[model samples]
Target: MFQETPQDALVGTWTNSLGTVWAIKADGTFQVSLSKNHRVDVWGKYTVTGDEMTIQESHGSHTPKSCRGKAIYKFMRDGEMLTFTKVSDKCKLREKNILAGWKPWKG
Candidate 1:
């Protein structure tokens, strides 16, 4: 039996410097914008244990090609800024950003 929701911290908008935006919701859904006026809507589920979180992209993008997959990440924040660092090499949404880390966004 579960008591209350988990990993509520991840439920919000996250963005990178490369114009990519991720809208993660608590209802097991996530949206990623790959470019201007272009976005990929997919399903996302996460498992949190201690300080580690695993994001599983259950469904890939609607586009023919996408970097959607499972990846392990660590959450960090500096004031209002939240970031995710890829601890696993499985996700390739943005190779450079993954290496450089992500930044939070409002839109």
Candidate 2:
């Protein structure tokens, strides 16, 4: 039996109640998009250590100037559901969006 790694558990597409989709890849990269229009809101790289995730946005739709900084979050996964708690983040918008929680995206 193959045991899933921490990265493996996080690698997939998840959607929030706000109709936003977050896709986390195996390459340490991630993208956030809107489900309605499929417009990418942000794209970035992330590193995970245990339950902690650090995200550094490479590009985004809003406040591009302020989005370059790294944001740290603590996340928990329960089956198909995933939730995040802020550890340290200077960007309020990013923090708000991430705290919304997510579930596996069937799409």
Candidate 3:
């Protein structure tokens, strides 16, 4: 039997009901695409602490300059699906969209 590690469970692409995509790799690096064209790419680093995940944006093209700092979210997992609930206001725009809910990328 193969055991799934906490880190392993989070290493994949996730998308919202609206088609926005967010990818979290095993290396702690992440990418988020807010648009269908994939032009708005946000690059950042993430860390997992218990049930909370914190994302720190170091650089990005389309992300808000003011919301470029650290973002905190409460996460829960259901099988292969992961949901992130934004708890930090640092990334207001991100919080607004993601605060609702997101699902793991199946494809």
Candidate 4:
């Protein structure tokens, strides 16, 4: 049987208004797919400590290798909704995506 951790509640697929699909896994990794085509746009690792999440982009189709920076945000999960408030993020593109927020993906 699979045991659930504190982060397990967040282990699932989430989507934003811009058709971005964010998949957070139990293995401390995440992937982002922009648009309905579902081609992975970004891949990275994330760590959650309490209500805060720190994300570092490892690779992306549109992200440069030199742009690997860690972004920290305070996250809140209210039922089916998930939102982020930036704590510190030097990467503008990444900050934009995080601020956009997400909801549980039904599909």
Candidate 5:
């Protein structure tokens, strides 16, 4: 068996529970928008290992001014499509949304 790389987790663009699209950049920066021309954050940090990935939300017009959110996801790749399930953790609201399959990822 071969060892897996952390970079693998950051390879695909993903959508949020609310149907927001977020692109995962090759340089570990992420861009997400809540609507057309209404980008929440132009850039943010990303950390990933194996099937798990976390995107750190940045300050922007689309995001809450006082909100500091991190989206943790488990990725599953099927051909050109990537399905990211939110990792619920201990947050009931977070868990519920993630498990509901509100997010999707693709090339």
Candidate 6:
């Protein structure tokens, strides 16, 4: 069971300089926006293990064509800096540390 609900913690707006954003809903519906003003609202069931946050965009209109392009943003940390990444079948590689989404409120 979740000890602390991100419901109160992660329930807010988060953005990256590249224009990607992660807006987490209290109920787990997540919305992500990209650099080109493109966005997808996903049914995101998430899990936080240590510094890693993994969210699967279960139900969204995101196309497979772009799934490997920019479907999701997975965040992790390395040593000190935070990293944002996306998993694309095209690359078959988890792009490492794109950019840590910005949250001024948390700072």
lDDT winner: 2
lDDT tens per residue, model 1, 1-107: 85644366666777777777777787766766767675674456767765566766546554223445666777765665666666884445444554454566766
Over 7-106, each residue of candidate 5 has an lDDT whose tens digit, in order, gives 6644556665565666767788767665555455545787777788776655564444433467677867665555668773433443443444433454
lDDT string for model 2 (1-107, tens) is 99877777788999888888889999999988854777887898999998898996658765456667988898888988899999998887777778998999887
Steric clash pairs (candidate 2): none
lDDT (C-alpha, whole model) for all candidates? 0.62, 0.83, 0.76, 0.82, 0.59, 0.47
Q: How badly does each model clash, as a count of residue pairs?
A: 0, 0, 0, 0, 1, 1
Q: Per-residue lDDT for 31 in model 5?
A: 73
What lDDT tens digits, residue by residue, belong to model 3 across residues 11-107?
Answer: 7888877778888888999888888876547888988887888886646777777777888888887876677776775766687666655677665
Q: Which is the better candidate, 2 or 6, if ranked by TM-score?
A: 2
Ranking by lDDT: 2, 4, 3, 1, 5, 6
Best by TM-score: 2
Displacement of residue 60 (Cα, Å) in model 3 is 1.7
TM-score of each: 0.67, 0.88, 0.81, 0.86, 0.58, 0.47
Compute the lDDT for candidate 4: 0.82
Per-residue alpha-carbon lDDT of candidate 4 for residues 4-94, written as tens digits (9 for 90 to 100): 5658767899998877889999899998887688888889998989888888666887775454878888888888888889899877777
The count of residue-pair clashes in candidate 4 stands at: 0
Worst 10 residues of 6 by lDDT: 88-97
Superposed on all Cα atoms, the candidates' RMSDs to the truth, in angstroms, are 4.1, 1.6, 2.3, 2.3, 4.8, 6.1
Cα displacement (angstroms), candidate 1, residue 94, comes to 4.7
List candidate 6 segments past 4 Å from native: 1-8, 35-43, 58-98, 104-107
lDDT of prediction 1 = 0.62
**How well does candidate 3 match the true structure in TM-score terms?**
0.81
